[model samples]
Target: MKKVSCIFIVDDDPITVFGIKKMLKSVASCDDIQIFQNGHEAHEAIKERLKEGKIIPEVVFLDINMPIMDGWEFLDELIALDIKEHITINMITSSIDPLDYKKWNGFKNRCPYTLNFKNKPIFKIEANDLGCMDIAS
Candidate 1:
């Protein structure tokens, strides 16, 4: 399997983005990770990259509960732009509300690029966590 290079993380907190990038580096999962303090910046950056014919991120870590442009708002804008055909978006939130889970589930179906959902403050990326399945017969 080919290793992914580009990573785009969107969140309102700078510290959170720093922590996520640090953790990913600690695990050596990726060498290049882009950080955006807000969804508006992330969206604009992604759009520019798309126009430049650059490959989008294989993994996106999104945080909910942001100002001006929350995760869902960003998702809507992303869908409207239609530049995430090959990208996988993973919701990384701290909320434990059942409704949040339900919304993500529904969004996964409604959105074209949403791949999965998970809580934020992640420290590791397990093979199983990335949706790798074993097939034996």
Candidate 2:
């Protein structure tokens, strides 16, 4: 598999962000790894990039729960935009609620390019739930 050039980590937790970043670095070769503290920031950046006719991130590791614009909200707004290219949206979250899966499935239906969401129990050197090598590759 080919490596991703650009990746976006959209999460509010600093610890989670750091863990993901480290895992990605160890497992794959990504030239640009951008971090967004919340979905709103990530959403804005995506829109800006689209407007400027710049290349969007190839992959997005999104967290479900967040303040000032959750993952669902971001996806809702995103689907409205004219994004023709494919983007692998990985909903990396700790929540195991049934509703989360249900909601995610709906988004999956709407988003043809998005991958199934992953609920990670832990992020570490030995990847399991955070399949950085597979995802990045």
Candidate 3:
């Protein structure tokens, strides 16, 4: 699999975070994995990295409903930042609301980089598939 420099898991659910982390370990070669409990924290961290001219995480697993700031809010804030790098945001969620899919479709079109949608507890195969996410870039 292609190596990744960094990854971020933005979710408030501990169990989901744990599961995703473990799955990622088995499927990818990323060495840096940062976990954020809320979108507010994640956004702030990203800002700090950008200020330092550091590479923003190449991949982010974002959940829709989180305290302090939801996934949509985080995405909005992130896209507004002056980032020059490519980011792959995987919308991992348990919400089955049809509205979420509609929202995702709209968001996907609006996103500047790769944006994918998936259910909670991402599978190993899907995680492994991320190796090719940067191919076109």
Q: Lowest-scoring 10 consecutive residues by lDDT in candidate 2?
A: 124-133
lDDT of 3 by residue, 1-137 (tens): 55779899999999999988888876678888899999999999999988898778988989999999999999899888847787888888888899999999998888897888887555553642363644636
- Find the candidate with the highest TM-score and give its number: 3
Estimate, for each residue in 1-137, the C-alpha lDDT of model 2 and write its tens digit: 23666788999999988888877776667788899988899989998988898888878888989999999998888788758877777888899799999998888887756565777854543332233445444
Candidate 1: C-alpha lDDT: 0.74
Please give the clash total of every predicted structure, in order: 0, 0, 0
Location of the lowest summed lDDT over 10 successive residues in candidate 3? 127-136
Model 2 has an lDDT value of 0.78
Give candidate 2 regions above 4 Å deviation.
122-137
The Cα RMSD in angstroms, rounded to one decimal, for candidate 1 relative to the true structure is 3.1
Rank candidates by lDDT, best first. 3, 2, 1
Where does model 3 exceed 4 Å of error? 125-137
Model with the higher TM-score, candidate 2 or 3 = 3
